[model samples]
Target: MYQLAPNIELLFTEAGPDAADRVRAAAAAGFDAVEMWGTSDKDVASLAGALQETGVSLTSLLAEPRTNFTLPGTDLGPFFTGLDRAVENAGLLGCPRVVLGSGIGFPGAKRPQNLARLVEVFTEAVERTRGSGVRLVLEPVNTRVDHPGALLDRTADAVLVAREVGSDSFGLLYDLYHSITEGEDPAAELANAAGLVDYVQIADAPGRGEPGSGAIDWAERLSVLRASGYDGPIGLEYFPTTPSVESLAHIKAVARDA
Candidate 1:
């Protein structure tokens, strides 16, 4: 069975008494590893302390100032600087994965030229972090519901970019919610991009909440993942309609039964 890590971004809405307290809460709730979103407001020292206190592992974090720097016209220099900081922080926090987002689509830019820019940028970023031991996860946000105008909305397209970039340190962050919202069949599409998918995250299709809270069958989906040989942690990335602890309790139970 693939291990699952709780995404602390949803569970702990506040920074609480201190960052270490957050790690305690995660452990109390039965999670061994914790993940975070944008680290803009976080104090690195406190988070580092928390990990030490609770023995909770820091799984992954999204690169800071989460913006679409991948758009054709946006300057990539600043984005690269932020990414470098994220890499440095990952080393301190013991996180193995960093989520990378591509900005929006350029209305007038030629599609192929824009794609080439993405390839070049990702290749350079990988080179800079070659010795850090942190892998970059490129995610395709769904343009249909949440982010409209995102350039890398298709999993297959992102896989193509990964191949073009030719970096073993970079790979796709296959998110099931966005793929379903955009009308892509997860099993079939994942099959096509089989070897290229490095990490997989999931949420129910319509609500972007916990699986089994909506129409998607967590059991069947997980079966597909296991059959396909993806033994990575199943990331719980979603917004909670109620308090995160309660919502996640349901998710844990469902995942257990599945």
Candidate 2:
């Protein structure tokens, strides 16, 4: 069996149910850790209580209230406020990671300017929680299907950004499905970015379901991750074409047998 953490985002039928119940259900189903989206579906305190009761750790959560991909140089007062609130909530839940996605890219804005803005925003975020022990993870989403306009689409680009910031508190989330769908060789890309990668999430391409549900060789890819020295928990941020429980079973099987 995989001796790592997993998020509960894949288990939800919708974002409509109680967050605590979702965490409890994931724990009951045998996940060591569970990550949640923003505080939209439910309150953070209730989710924290459920985690405490089940003894499951809140692995990660999203920084919310950011409507657009406002870079650092622009007006980011609102974005920083949301990030601070998210950091505080993450600290409360005892979660060590916070997945931070840059806002959508604006074609009108200059590339250099946007990159500079991102560095500023991330640097500020790192500075806010100097001793909190929470990592602000930047996720590069695939612009093909789900998120078509995300700022950081390439893993290499994420690594560059992380290197520019040069802080342990800031790192990359490295979603495999997005990287694969965007035509990146996960192994080579990850190898090139081994230093900046802090967390890794996985799902098959095309369908965004569990491993082995699509054409991707999940076992080979996972073995590559293991060989590459990434022992972090793989986040299951996928969409279930079928029911979630069935998909979860498939994911567990893949992890156990791979």
Candidate 3:
């Protein structure tokens, strides 16, 4: 069975704004792991305490300020500063990974040029974060539905950038929801991405809701993921149309046997 880390930002809001309480709630609900977007606004002390008390692992968190390398003349100082902060917080939370994004591309810049810029920026990022014990995973978000005009929308492109960065510390976050929403086949993309994927996340397509709320074949997709050789925890990064626990029933059942 695969371990599932629910995204607390979207999963346990019923526990209210303090993510520390959400960590406790998730632990009570039998989740041993959770993920979130950013830590800038959170009480790190409280969060760390809760995780320690509950023994729940923080699987991943976002790299803040999501630097847009495609934008010309963009100041990178703040981006690097934010990354340092992210690494610090990850250390406090015992998180293993930090998710990075391409941000929206600079208007009228060629896609290749944008991707090349991403390579340059991420190469430096990987080098900077080396030996921190926190792996950096670059995510390719869907531009069509949720993130319009996002620079890295294709899984192949993300894999290429990860390849160019050429470090085990730097790898890809192959989000299945975003991939399907972008009209890519799961089997094919997972095959192409292969061993480079260090993280994975999921939501059903069309509505971005919990699995079974949309058209994806969970068993088939999970099988494809297994075949692709990624044994890491999968982040449940979907919105719920029902109560969070109820929303998980479908994927939980499917994943248990997958």
Candidate 4:
């Protein structure tokens, strides 16, 4: 089974949901690794201290503050600034990967043109993070479900963007729930993703709930992951149906079944 990195940003809200509190809560919930989003806007000292105290490893975080990646007109200055800050924080947290949300599609532009702009910006982003020990993965969300009009919703598109970037520093975030929501076959997609995936995240489709709460076959999903030899952390980025500890029953079930 893949090591699970609980997304503290989406889980562990019972303990005040403060960044450090989430880290401590994830550890208390028996998770050894955790991922976060928007950690740059949080108290890094406290978060870093909590990780140190709990001995929890940081898995991944967002590359920049959430913004539209598909737009050619939007100024990338703030995005790049946020990326630099995130890289620095990743260094402090010992996080190896960061995720990028390929935002909603651009209005009044062809898809190729939008992708072209995205490639250009990410090219610069990859260069900017050179030697930072931090790598990037473009995260593809499902447009038909949770994210309408989201660009880069397909795993293939993210892989294509990473290929165009042509840098080892860039890769794809294969989120299973999103792919399933988008009506993708997870196993075939993972097989297609083969070499370009840097990270993985999971949630159940239809409601974005815990693994077993929806129609997703996590057993099959994990099987494909194992077959693909994906060594990266699999983030538990889902909404719990109950208390945080109670939410982990699925993880236990997965381990036992595996």
Best by TM-score: 3
User: How badly does each model clash, as a count of residue pairs?
Assistant: 1, 2, 0, 0
lDDT of 2 by residue, 1-258 (tens): 454455565665444477788777777677778777776556878888988999988777888764434654446777777787788888889988888887775446776666766787789889987888889898888888878767777888778788889997888888889999999988898888887777888788778876668988777887887777787777787766766666777667767854
Ranking by TM-score: 3, 4, 1, 2
Model 3 misplaced regions, further than 4 Å: 67-72, 106-108
- Compare candidates 1 and 4 on lDDT and give the better one: 4
> Relative to the unseen true structure, what is the C-alpha lDDT of residue 194 in candidate 2, on a scale of 0 to 100?
80
Clashing pairs in 1: 68-103
Per-model C-alpha lDDT, please? Answer: 0.79, 0.76, 0.90, 0.82
lDDT ranking, high to low: 3, 4, 1, 2
**Over the stretch 45-149, how does candidate 1's per-residue lDDT look in tens digits?**
888888987888887788865774654457777788889889888888888989988777445667677677788888998998999999998888799998897
Give the TM-score of each candidate: 0.92, 0.91, 0.97, 0.94
Q: Which is the winner by lDDT between candidate 3 and candidate 4?
A: 3
RMSD to truth, every model: 2.0, 2.4, 1.2, 1.7
Clashing pairs in 2: 69-103, 72-117
The TM-score that candidate 2 achieves is 0.91
Give the lDDT of residue 209 in candidate 2.
74
Candidate 1 TM-score over all chains jointly = 0.92
TM-score between candidate 3 and the true structure: 0.97
Per-residue CA lDDT of model 4 for 51-164, tens digit only, reads 999999998988665763445667677788888888888998888987888776566768788787788888988989999989988888888878887877788877777889
**Candidate achieving the largest lDDT:** 3
